[model samples]
Structures are given as C-alpha cells and as structure tokens.
Target chain A: MRNSFLTVVIFAVLVSATYFYLKSPEIVQTKLEVLKENYSKPRDKKPVDHSKFEVLQKQFNSPQEVVKTCMSCHNEVHKELLDSPHFRWQRPVYENGRGVTYLGKANAINNFCIGVQGSEVSCNKCHASFGEEEAMLAIDANAENIDCLVCHDNSATYLKGNNMNGFPDKSVDLAVVAKSVGTPTRDNCGVCHFFGGGGNNVKHGDLEKAQFHTTNEIDVHMADNGGNLICIDCHTTENHNIKGRLFTVESSNTNRVSCTDCHTELPHESTVLNEHTVKVACQTCHIPTYAKVNSVNTNWDWSKAGKLDANGKPFETEDSLGDHVYKSIKGTFEYARNKKPDYIWFNGTAEHYLLGDKISEKETLLVLNKMNGNYNDEFSQIIPVNIHYAKQPFDPGTRMLIQPKLAALAKGEGAYWQDFDWLKAAEKGMEASGLPFSGKVDWFNTVSYWPINHMVSPKENSLQCVDCHNSENSRLAGLNDFYMPARDKYELVDTLGNLMILLTIAGLFAHGSLRYYFAKKQK
Target chain B: MKEVLIYKGYERFWHWTQAVLIIFLAVTGFEVHGGYSFFGYENAVVYHRYAAIGLVVLIFFTAFWHFITGEWKQYKPTPQFVKEQIEYYLLGIFKNAPHPTKKTVLSKLNPLQKLAYFGLMVVIIPLLVITGIIYLFYRMPSATNMNPLNLTNLEPIAILHTIGAYLLVMFVIVHLYLITTGHTILSNLKAMITGYEEIEEDDDHHKKEEKKV
Candidate 1:
C-alpha cells in the first residue's frame, strides 16, 4: 500500500510538471510576439544609429544627394549593388543561337506593357537606381547611382516618385530615411515587389499587399502572425546576388531554393506521403490557391486600351467586385481571386522567347516563356503555376512580338499614352529596341507562367488524400503517366477482378446449398 | 469418454492469431484497394501496414514451431485414403457412412484435409505472403535514391497480390465449411479450440463415453 501511494505521488508530480511546462510563456506565445505587421524594430542592435552620424545630417538638396551621402560611407556595398540585376535591370545569358547574349527587362518583351524600352521614366520607379537607369541603351550606372536607402530602409515610409525617373517622391524626408537605415524588411522589399506589373498583386498571383500583415492562414512564412520571414531569409544573398531566380525572366536553373534546404529529403512522417515528394513539389500541395486576399490580373487585352469617353479623356471603370476591369490607358482586364493553379511538370529550367526571335506559327497562343520538363525527366516534379494570359500586339509581316512605347515625356512624342496610336508607338519602341516594326498591328493571345511560391497555408490546411486521389477532376487530373492507386485503375482489370470474386461467392453458395438439401433429406 | 490431443499449444495459438490477423487485414486491405470507405483511406493504409507486419511476425513464429516440433509432416497428404476421403465428403457423409480415415493423435488430419492444407501451405499462402511483401517494399525506378532490388513498376506485383488475397478468401470459406463435416457439426471446431477430440471407435455411431489424451 505504501509503494502504491509512492507510485501515485510520483505520477502526479510528473503530470503537474508537464502541465506547467506548456503553461510557460515562451512555448505558447512566441509565435505571436515575433510576428506583427509593423513590429517594434530592434534599435538595440543598431550600434551605429546613423541618426548621430554627421554624414547623413546634411542630406537636403535632392534624392541624389542622399545617395551621395549614403555612398560616402558605403561605397564598397554600393559598387556591388551597381553590378546586380536589380540595379542594371539586365543580365548576361547564354542563349541557343547567340552563345552569350545580354538581355533584361529593358529589352525583353512581356505580355504586359510590352517592354520598358521607351517607358524608362515610368518603369524605373521600381528599378534599384537613383536616376536615368536605362539598360536598353548602354547603362552609365556607378557607385553614386546605387540606391541604398530603397532596400536598406527600416523606416518603412520611403516612396519612389511615379514616372519621375527612379527618384524618391518629393514628399519623402531623405534625412529621416537615411538616419533609420537597416536590413531590408518585408515592407521594404514589398513596397516595389508587391506592386510589380503596375499595381498591387498583379504580377505574381501569390505575392500581394495582404502578405505584409496577414495571419498564418494566408502565408505561413511571411504572415505577421506566422514566421514573419523577410525576402532575403530564403532568397539568401551574397555580394548583392540573390540566390533564388524567377522562371519568368531567368533562363538558368543553377540558382534556386527548395523546401529541402531546411526540411529532410522526406519531410512527411508517413512513408505514403514521403513517397509523393519524389514526384510532387512541396509548393504544389502547400499553396492550394494563389491570390488569397486580392484579385490578380488573370487576363489583359491591349486591343481595348485607348478607349476615350465622350468627354475625350481616358477613364477607369470598376467591375461589380470593385476590381478595376477597364483602365482606359491599359485596357480590359479579368481579375481572379483565390484561384487554383495550373499544374505542370517543371524541372526548374525555363526557355524564354527573346525579342527579334521569329515566330513561324500562325494564329496560335504564344507562350512567352515555357517551363522545361516532361514526365520522363528524372528531375521533374509537378509544380503549380499561374498562367497570366493576354492579347497583345505583334508584327504580322515581321512575325515578331511588338513592343509599344507606353509613356511620354512630352505631348505628340509618338508614345502610346500621348499619341494614342499603336503603329507610331510600335515604331518608336522598335527604333529604341533596334528591331523592325511591320507598320501593322495584329493582336495575338500570349501567356507568361508565374510559379506560385508564397502564401503557404498551415500544415493542418494541407491537401487531404481525396483531393488528388479521387476519380473526378482531381488536382492532378492532367498528369496521367503513371498508375496512382485511388485515382487510376484499368477498368477491364477491375471488372474482371470483381467478377472472379463474385463467381467464387456464387460457387460457394451453390455447393453449400446442395450439401444442406442432401443432408436434410437424409435426416 | 475417449479424448485425444489433436493440436499442440503453439499450433493452436499460432492458428487463431493468424486467423484473426488475416481477417482484419482483409477488411482493411480491401478498403485501401478502393473497395469501400469504412476506415477511410489514410487509416486503412496505416492499419493494413501494421497488420501485415503482424502477419509476417506470426508466420516467423509458426515456421519456427513447425520446424522444431516436426509437426510439419502432418500436412503431408497420404496416398492410402485419398480416394475414400473424397468419396466420403461427396457421397458417404449424407448417407451416414463412417469417416473414411480414422482420427489419431499422430495423424490428426484426414486425407482430404491433408491435401488442402498442403496446397495452402506451399502455394496460396506463400504466394500471398511473397507478393504482399514485394508490393509493400518495392519502389519506383528512381523514387528517392538508387533502387537496390531493381524492381521498377508496381502493376504486376499489385495484381498478383490482389489475386492471392482473393484465393485466400476462397480457401477460408471452404475451410470453414469443412470443419462442420466432423462427427457432430461442432466436433472439429471443439477439437481445434480445446485441443481434444472424442472419437467413437465402434461402428454404431452413437454417443459414447470419451477419454482425452
């Protein structure tokens, strides 16, 4: 009896200790404390608070002055920044016909506003430079041109001037931003990134403003109530070259990040689930829907742009969902929210269609950049992507995709926004890009794929077995190379198997019945 | 009363455990094969794996027992009463003809029982176990790393395991029926359960006092 009492007392103490262990603050509330939209910056770590530095005290004349002062102390870092793609907006790529060709956003044509050749003043707002950074023509960027305050600002209030040649807005306090420089936060990177392709959540469907301060339900890594990871956390950088590459612009697969970087080769505890990781990417299952909070530009038709109202001015109209469906300067658009992605086998390499490349196919939807992989490829896995489709102009005679000059510095400059003429703008843009325009505009359907890489839901919200294992319209319904047990079966084999089982049952019944009848007669 | 020890301790223990495990595996296994959704797919897969491992363990113990005690010879079908045993099951049993082969402690199984058990031991059971193990362990051509066994596709192994399972089910049904064909309908079952059987040696076929060994 005494030993039994001692055992019970020991068990009680163990239970009490475990109960209090979970009740401790660190274990329960760390997830909340570390993740707020605008959490208090750790000023203690700023040993050199630039607020006291005399170099930043006199930055008053212009945005260039702020850059000169920033370079006064950080010239070495600024020099590295100038060589980055973020600064020059171009990179050297090894192409098929041309061994090593220089290409970038400046000359490369997308299904969106075509190219940045003649729209430098407007597009350079997002470019990582101070002023006049156009690489279509030779770029003259140096250490003084590097925009350090844009990426390193922790103040989260720096705004770039719209259509002002990459300068900060006139209202921005250059001294205040210079005094508060630190490592880039989600707010700093997201200021331009979340607004890529002109507006919020329009370029990559998975990236949006909601990610700046969302809960774990939308994005587990970047959510204000989740891991609160910044851009550079996974896209790690060395000497200003980010590790991750986007398939939309990049051609090489050398620089990429994967879930296996931190997780095990087989992350799932169950072997059944781990078996799937070989043929399926983590993002394919983790990111079930893209554009979770805002509507993304799924369709854009440039043919409908320049539609002036009776008052002779371009006007904007909103759809019933309050999303802009018609921007007279950009055209008719179709936006989609919480959209399921198109699944494709991608081995991470992509082949982009460079400008001046002839298109031989007629009356077909052109893929501007096609992801490279097949079911037979050893390195391929099913990945989810958002295909943004568009109807844009191309040269009918030259069979080349046309890039129209979309912005103007002055009136009647042959820019599409000023003259409202496609042929004239195409001529000017082609002249800038050193490509020929056929003097005729014909719009064709084009698409660019953007792989979903963010807004991962919680583990509890992962796909259940039936999501892909069901017979009807499975998420992987398009992938049919191999036999998936629940989702695939040979109809003939199944019928024969069921019939054989049935025949056995029938035979057993008949034999058992006969035995019972004969035995009853004898009895 | 005349009673004899028909089954040893380990034999009875192994047989009942194997029986329970096989039945449970069938229920869960068919569900995993998309036959029905009783336990749900995930639970069915998990439970089927556990029970399959249990069956493999039980088979190991049974093999050791059979080898050590030399009880494996009991499943060898004897040529002496093979014809008479078949005729008895087909025609003699309904007309009250005496059992063609007498039951003894050394030769507990009848000629027909010997033949069926022998077939099951060598063919159907081995087929099921071998194919099931391959199906469980086989990997695709390059799933994780290099496949050591060089077994690529799972289609053939899956179909073969499925056919083996169906045949095992058929054998079980027939075996359950044959157990009732003893002196009384429950006598064979009682012998298996209690490890004792009372056989009347006289031709009268009436109830008699019994002694159990």
Candidate 2:
C-alpha cells in the first residue's frame, strides 16, 4: 500500500512537471505589456537639435560647401566611412588561387545590370560617396568628399542627383538638409536598398518600397503597428561598419547578421520544433512567401532588347498588374508576387561569379553564384532563396559573359542604349573593362540566387508538419539526401515490420478456430 | 472451487499497470512514426516522450522488486520441458490434453514463458528505452555543441527503435491471446486481478503440504 501510494505521487509529479514544460514557453499578456513598455523604439537617445548650432545656420550654397561645414565640427568620422564596403564598392576577399582580391559591386557580375566596372557614373548614385565618379577600381577615394547627410539626415527631403556623380539633386535645399541631420531612418536606408534594381522589389523579393510603412502581414518586425523595429535593431552596427551583408556582392560569411542574434537558437515552445532548427534556418519557415505587396522581377530576357516601335523610337508595355512586361532599352520581363521561395543549402559562405571567371561549356544553365554548401557539410542548413532567371549575352569563342555598354558615356559611343548595336557595344565595354571581347555575340540562359531573409509571418501562420512531412507537395521535396519520416520509406523496414505483426495475427486466428472446433466436437 | 494464492498483491499491482502503460505508449509511439494519427503530431510527440520516461521508471521499480524477492529466478529458462511445452501449445491444447508443466509460486512460468519473458526483460525493453532516449535528445545542443558524446544522424537510431516497437506490438498480441489458454477462458486475467486462482490439487502442492505437515 505504501509503495503504490508513493508510485502515484511520483507519477503525478512527473506529469505536472511535463505540463509546465509545455506551458513555460508562453508569455503572459501582462508580461508582454511590460516588455513593450521597456522596449526602446529606434531613436537616438542623446537629443541634439542641430538647428540651434552656429555652423549649420550658415548658408550652404553648394553640395561641396555643405560637406566642408559638417567636417569642421564632427571631424575624423569620414575615415571610418571611407573604409566601409558602402564607399569602396568592394570588400577585400582572399580567393582560393589568387591571394587577396577586392570583389564586390564594382567587379562582381550579376544577371541584372551586368556590372559597374565601366558604368560608375550612373551606378555611383548609391555608392555612399560624392565626386568619386570613375571608381571602378579606385580604392584611395578622397575622404574629404564623403556625403555624411545621406544617412544622418533627419530631414526627409534630401535626394541624390540623377546620374551626376552622386551629388544632392538640383531641387534639394542643401542648407535645410544639413541642419536636419541626426541619424538614419527607414527612409534613408530604403531610398537605395528598397529600390535596388531600378524599381521597387526588383533585386530582393523580400525587400520593397512597401517596407517603409509596412503592415504585419508583410513583416512582423518592421511593421508600422507591430514590432516597429528598424533595420539596425537586429543589424547591430559597430562604428561605421554595418553588421550585415548580402551574398550578391559579398563572397565570405564573416560579417553577417542572423536571427539568432535577437532570438535564441531554440525559440519554439515544443522540443520537437527546436530540434529542427539545427538543420533548418528560421527564415525557411517564418518567411513562407516573399514579395507580399508588389510583383518582383522574376525573369529578364535581354535577347529582345533591340525591338522598336513604328516611329523607330523605344517603347514600353505593362502587364495587367502594372509590372513592366517589356521595355525597348532593357528587355522583356516577367514578375510575380506572394511567391513560394526555392530552397538551397547555405552556410553563410558564397562563391560570386567575378568579372574574369570563365563560364563552363558543358553547363547550359550558368548560375552566377550559390554553391556554398553540400548535404554532408556540418555547418550547412536549408535556406529559402528567390532565383531570378535571365537570358543574357555571352561570347561563343572565349566562353565569357559579354559586358555590353548599356548606357552611353558619350553620345553614340557604342552604347547599346544609344546605337542599339551589339557588336560595337561589346567592343567598347570589353575595352573599358580590360578584356578582349570576341567579335561574335551569342545569348545564353543564366540563373542567380538571392537568399530571402525578411518578411517574417506571425507565429500562427508558420508551417505545420504536414507541409514538409507529407509524401506529396512537400516544401523540402528538392532535398532528398536524408531520410525524413512520412516522406522517405526504406524497403527493409516496411517488409520486416509488416511480417512481424501479420504473423502474430495469423497465429491467433488459426489457433482460436481450431480450439473451438475441438471443443464443439467433444461436447 | 479451491482458490489458491497464484499472484501476490504487489505482482498484481505492477502487472496491470505495466499492461496499460505499454498499450498507451504503442498508440502514441506509432503516431510519431507516421503510421496514423490518433493524437495530433505535436501531442503525439510530447505524450510519447512522457510515456517512455514513465516506462523507464516503472522498469526500474520492477527490476528492484524482482531482485529483492528473488522472483527473477522464475524466468530463468530450463531446457528440460521446452519441447513438451511447445508440443502442448501446438497440438495438445486443441485435443484437451494435460499441460506439460505445473505452476507454483516459486516457478510461475513454464519453459516457453520463461524464454519469452527473459528476452522481453533482457533485450527488447532495454533496446526500446535506450534508443528512445537517444532519439529524444538527438541534435539537442549542449555546452559542447550537442550531447555529451555528440551523436548525430537519427536515421539508424530511429529505424532500430521502430523495429523494436514492432516486435513489442507482436509480443503484446501473442501474449494477450495466450492468456485464454489457462484452465478457463479468463482464469489468467482473473488471477492477475484478484491475486487468487482456482488451482487444481496437484502433486506439486501435495508434496509441499506433506513437507510442511
């Protein structure tokens, strides 16, 4: 009796402990209220009204004069800004064969825009520098001309000039923008990042113009009424060097931010869900579909770029959803919104397709990048990606991608936009980039991967087990290297398991029937 | 009816409790293996883990009781009546012939029962419990990155556990059917429940009574 009572006591204690274990991850409403009260919204704690300062009150006649006045007071900050990848347009990388090479926005080849090697004047609009027009390979840029107000401006009216060496626009009041300088806002970062590839939601499917005043359905963190978190909340910057990087321009995994910086590695209420975090990233489930607002550029076929209207002038057409379906100067395009992302195995490292890298002849579909991990790699996890396909020009003889001059440096200087001639544009573009372009130009299909890391959904909208654990239409159906329950079946296990149980049932039925026959005969 | 003490109070308590717990475990365990869903996936996983821990504790107390009272000797197989027990189960039960061996307090199990129970305690139970523990804690991060030994790759361990679970299901079915082979249809179950059975006045008990007198 004593032992039975003790057993019941122990059983109750174990059960109660397990109940609490399942309940412990939930936060009470009152505790969340306290957390919200204590949580510091994105703002500079030290308030300094710059309008009252004596230096800022002076008339800033020109863009260079505005920089000259700001340098007089907050000096030596330009040194940190000069060394950043934002200003230099490249990061110092140690390649496998070549010792150390600078490869990034300037020299790296992407499917969109090709590169910035010979087209620095137009591309330098987002380069975070001023008056460094032809910085294709220039490293020792003048720190005296760094544009400080582009990020520090609180004035919302500042705008960079269109194709004028990244100066403040002709309409911008330089004096007003200089006096309103405080810290970077969502608008300051979104002016370039949100509109990366010429328009909204073009480069990254997760980022777009709607993220400035976003809703919870688009992003849980940056939503205007939700977490209201700015980019730097989880991005945690040290000095002028920001704490994140995108694989499109970067080749290494050293300086990047992750969800684990703010959330724990195992943040789920259930232990089963936490175990999946080891082999799967947080974004793979949280961000089920990207580009929730506007349609992102999915395909670009540059082979149809030379088409003209009846009047011999360039024309453009839009799809039913207002996406630019065809453009005379650029090419044909296909866009999609609320799209499910493709998956890849990544461990933060990337192998970018540099300018001089040779393209393989056997591979019909050339991937610009995205070969950083394998299934056997210990540091790898399945991450979601948005693959943008493009039909771009390539050389048949040398097997290298052709960098055709798309925009004109001088009028009719072999620019494809000016003359609409492929041969001459290839010649001038290769000459400017220091490569020998073959006379023959051919078009080939190319694919590139952009990892989607934003637009987190709410907790209730996360994927269930049936999403990836089912036999059909599994989200992870592409990854077949490992055995997953409900998806993978081994022949030996199925056969042995079935035989063992079926034999037990057959034995019972035969024995029971024979015994009944014998007993009835005896009676 | 001559009612004899065929089971002790503690033995009845543990046997019925173990049967209920094992059936509950199999129901939840198979669901987690993607067989079918009685409970939802999340609930199945949670309850399966809890029941596995409960069975481990139950086995601890059972082994302690068996060792303290020296009742574990009942399950030590002897090859003397092995063939006779097999033959009786195969053919003699249908013809209403006599049993191959007699049951007593000290020797509760026959030759076939001894072998099955011995393997159950020594092999299958331990296999399921150990594999279950590794399955529960697989890929769980520790101070040294993972577990103490840092064992990964859950495929092999899960397969082994799954095989053991199937074998246990087979054992439960066969064991349930054999309970009807006693003197009456439900005599064995009644003996376990009430700690008494209408045993025959056989020579084994007569000899013990003679020695006591």
Candidate 3:
C-alpha cells in the first residue's frame, strides 16, 4: 500500500510539473502584452527651446551723420567707438561709389579704405551726412558721434512712418529708454560686428567651433533669449572702464557698464568652487581684445610704409621698408613684404581658404620667405580663419585691417615660425592655456605681442538663465522657446514598467495562495 | 509489521537544507524589493543573492542524492483520490474536513504534496534563477560585436526582477501558513524538526499483527 501510494504521488507530481511548465510561457506572455499596451499611452511633455536670438531681415540707413555729429559734442565717446571695430569696413574703396576716378575708373577697387565721402547717400546711413543732400553745406551738420539713446530705447517700437529706409525701425518705448536696454543681446552687438565673409571680406574670428557654442552659427552678444553673455556680460562700463586695458577701460562716465555688470557671476560654476566671494575678475584672465592683424591694436598703421606726403617727402614708419601693395603710405595695403629672415609666408587668404584649415609647415615657410618675413601670422600663418570681407558691395569708409601671421611671430627668438610647425605650435598653445582652438581665431596683436581676450572668444559666450529675462535684451533667446515651446513629456517606457510590476505581484500572490490551500488539504 | 527506512540522514539533511535556503531567499528577497527593510535593503540583497546561489547548488546535490538513494519515488503520485485532494483544497479546506490521504513511513507525502513540491522544484525555482541572473549582470554585457555598452535605462529589467521577488514572497506566506494544518496542529512541524512522527493507527487487528511480528 505504501509503495502504491508513493507511485501515485510521483505520477501526480510529474503531471503537475509538466502542466505548470507549459502554462508559464503563456502567463508571462500575457503579462508582458498587458504592460506593453499600457505603456503606449502618451504623456504630456514639451521640448526645450534653446535658441536665444532672431535674425532680422531688415536693414536701415540713418539720414544724418548722427555718429559723427554726436562725436563733435562727445569727444570721449567718439574716440572710443573710432578705436572700436564698428567704424571700420573691410571692403574695397570706391569713388562716388560709382566707379568714378581720374584714371577713367575701372572697378579694380582698393580692398581697404578710410571713411566714406560726405556727399554720398549710400554712405550716409552708416556714415555722417554733412547737410541736406539736395543742398550740401557745412561738415559740422554731419556728426561724428554715436548717440546711445537713439537705437537703445527699450520702451519703443519701430513705427511704419519713422522707418523710411525700409530698415526695421529700432524704435523702443520711452519708458524702456528711461531704463537700460534690457541687459544686452547678441543683436545689440551684432548690429556692426560680424564673422565669416566672401573673398576680400574679413572673417573677424572663428565662432564655428562646436565646443564653444555647439554650432557654426555666429552668436551676436545680445542674441541669447535665456540671457547669455552680453556686451556687458564681461566688460563692465564701471570697473572695466577704469580697468587696465583699453577694451576694459571703465570710466566713471560709463561706470555702471561691465559685461559682469549684468552677467554678474561666472555662468560656469566649477565643481570645486564653494564660496561666491572668491570669484574671479572677468578681464583678470581675458587681458586683450582679439584681432586678425599683427598691428598696434585693431588700428592698422598704414604710415609704416614710406609714402609721399602732401609736400612729397618720403615718410617711412619705424617697421616699414617700403614693401606693400598701396602706392601711398597713408593708404591701407592688401599685402606686405615679409621682413623676417627665418620664416616663410603665404598670401593664400584669397586662394585655398576655409575658416579652420591646418597650415602645412613646408608650404607656410615657403610663403613666409617670399614675404621677406614681414609675414603677418594673423593672416599668413598656417592656422585657419574664415575671412568675412566687405559684403554689402559698398564701402563703409573706414579701413578694416586683416593680418594673418601674428600667432607665429611671438618670442622674437630662433625664428619660432620656422623652428615650430604652425599646427603643433597652436595646438600646444591652446592646450596649455586650456582654450579651445576648433576654428575660433580671435587673438589681437598689439605692438609685437599677441594678447587673447576672453570677451571676444566663445569661451566667454554664456549659457546663463537670466540672459533673456527682459524682452529688450534677448531678441531671440526668449523668442525661440516661444516659437518652439519645449515639452518635457513622460515616455512610454515608464508606464510599461509600472504595469509589469503591478500585475506580476498580484498574480504571484494569487497563485501562491492557491498552492498553499492544496498543500494544506493533504496534511 | 512493516519496517521501511523512508529517509536516511543525508536525505533529511538535503530536504531541511533546501527548505531553510528557500525561506531565507524569500525573506531577504522581499526586503530587497523595498518591502519594509529588515537588515536594510543593501544587506538584504546580499543575503538574498547568497541564499539563492546556495539553494541552486543544493538542488544539484539533492537531485544526485535522490537518484542514488531512489528517494525520487517519494514524489510519485496516484490518480486515485487525486480529484478528491483537489476538491478538498478548493472547497473542503474551509469546512475542517478530514484529510483524504494518509502518510506512512515508506510513503510520506500525499498526491497534493507531491504535485506542489514537484512544480516548485521544476518550474518556479528555475524561473527565479534565470530572472535573478539577468538582474544581477544586466549592466555588464560580454558581447564583443555589439556597440559599446549602450544600455542607458535599467527600468524594464528592474521590473522583471521585482516580479520574481513578489512570487517568492507569495510562496513563503502560503508555505508558512500551511505548516499549522497538521495533526495535533504541529505533527508535520515536529516531524521535520526531529525526523520522527507519531502515526495514528486506527485498526486494532493491524496493531496486533504488527505486535506479533
């Protein structure tokens, strides 16, 4: 009887085991299907709008020589702007802007020139107008100053009647004008500053690197809607005005203006930094303004080349050996003869050009030698620079300096240009400085040394939240989010996860209870 | 009259070892599933995994012991009264009914006990083991040809592992409650603890025959 009972129990167990094994797959499948179905339901979410600036298609020309006119009354402000890059145009010089000169005027225009003629209407918008064009008069009527209040009014909007040039009128409300332009935007600075252009155009710097702003698009200082680095983001009109460098000269007059005045603390907080008081000064590390030319400041000294003065005397500058493209010493030159013995130079900005190309050592030295070592590494050096030339097809009157060989001319020893490969030299330099050299070339040459500015470089560009709090500041940073509102929605994976866990727990409990009852009854 | 050695020392050893391991696995496993932390979640997980691995290894040894000793015959179930055992569990369990099958030294567990124990060993344990392994090494993939460890989310695997945990919890609850239903309210419990049980002999003739032997 005991043996038979054992036999019966073993037989029943085998059958039950087989049945459970077969049923498990179906149970697991059903549970998984239910979870998958539940997960498909949509959750409310939105994508993030990260762009801060908008591109305005309209262009406007001012009727009066407003900048010049204002300059007569405000000499200090006039000098500051004149020294700044805004007044200069890197385009070719024109006679009457109509190809009219004493030599029967063929349009082989000069690439660099000083300010525009007073009588021309095309030049008036960006230039100073003398008087009414219909009745040309005194030069005083055309001002040399840039009035801060005109385009900077925050409370105004461009009315149809006020904007005759079909240029978008920068009319703001008087209330906003009473206050400050809502912290600055990329557009506020981009109105005059630009990067990358056609042949003979000046590419001021490399703004196309991904590490800097994650894109190739040039970011005007005021463009960040979320309130990125503005003009005052780093350079303060107060502390920066009285500060050491000209770029950071903070005058009591512009006291409240520092890039830090509005941007405040550093946008990037270090994981190590615990205290706020120990924060660094903006220009303490950023030192000088960026430029493409190896000249004293952004102002190129054309007088260096010997030119016949009005009295027709040979006037040679300290550095110039009378080797340049321009015939007159006072006029700007497109190319310069190499003065250094150990290096080679290339005037290939016109020929093989991309914003960021690697310069070959053999090819570069060959070009440097041809220019007699007077090679400006800012332009001729092996590093890549996307040149943004005069694009409007019209001259803005001021000479825009473009130097290509300044980076390689440092240390004044061992002909560093020849001894070192331009690529290695730059890479090492950037690595040591902890600066990115993807395609951004914004180093300025003052006297013999090149100083890098953090303000102009994308390193200084911000990713701040408050960069676009006020509408007047970030024209696009705020607008882009609205244009494409970001929705942070929950994904289907989460729903499925919840369902699987719930059903699995419930089913297991029920099955176990049933098993317990069966086991208990046989006891 | 009948003298049969139903279980040897090693046989009882393996049975009790397996039972302890299962119980430990269930308790710690639930704790790891964020169910009221006892010994903390991290400690509970460590204990659960250790017990599970021990249990799996014990199963191999137990299966070998069973085969060598022919103890696998104990789980053999008969169809006669199989339906009655099922009905007893389904309906009569609540009515305080008498048990349909009896336990002898040579033939210990009834048809229902055989069936439940067999399902657990063959199906549930293996399922738990597979799901547990997937959970532990879900982060580390050894595929040489695949893209460098692209797994960013762990929620799905976590859910599956948690399901296995819940199953173990249910089994433990029912198993614990069933121990109280034996004769004298503790006979089976005493038998497992001491390896001896007092069997009820209802036939006086059979008793006289056993005494004469």
Q: Which parts of model 2 are misplaced by more than 4 Å?
A: A7-35, A38-46, A95-99, A131-134, A137-139, A409-411, B140-144, B204-213
Error of model 3, residue A274, in angstroms: 30
The digit string of per-residue lDDT tens for model 3 on B62-92 reads: 6876787787877765555679877875666
Residue-by-residue lDDT tens digits, candidate 2, A1-523: 6876776677568767866775475433233344355555546675788888888887777776887787888677767777777777787886545557887776777888787655556677776777645254244566656778788778899888877667778888888898888768788888889888778998898988899998888898889877787777777777878888788777676778888765666566566777688778899999989989998888999898989999888899998899999998789999999999988888777776777678887879988875587555667788999999999888887788888877755667788877788898788778878988879899989889999998999877777776777666889899887667666656698688889789879979999999999999999
TM-score of each: 0.85, 0.91, 0.30
Once fitted onto the true fold, the runs of candidate 1 whose alpha carbons sit more than 4 angstroms away are A1-44, A93-104, A137-140, A266-268, B74-127, B140-152, B181-183, B198-213
lDDT (Cα, tens digit) per residue for candidate 1, span A1-523:
3643453465446545644542343312223333333344542475677888888776577767777887777767765665678877678876445567765675466877777877788887888776664333234455566667789877877888888888888889887898888778888889988988888999898888998899899998887767777788778888888888787787766779877765556666566676678778899888899899998888999999999989888889998878889988888999999999889988767777777877877649888888887665667788999889999888999998888888977768888887789999999888877898889998888899988888888988887776777676689898777666667666666677677778877866776677778778987
lDDT of 3 by residue, A24-83 (tens): 432112232343354344321324211221211122244133233334444565444333
- Report model 3's TM-score to 2 decimal places: 0.30
**Candidate structures ordered by lDDT, highest first:** 2, 1, 3
- Greater TM-score among 2 and 3 belongs to 2
DockQ of 1: 0.25
**Tens digit of lDDT per residue, candidate 2, span B124-168?**
988898888888777622222545546545678888888888888
Model 1 chain B: weakest 10-residue lDDT segment is B204-213
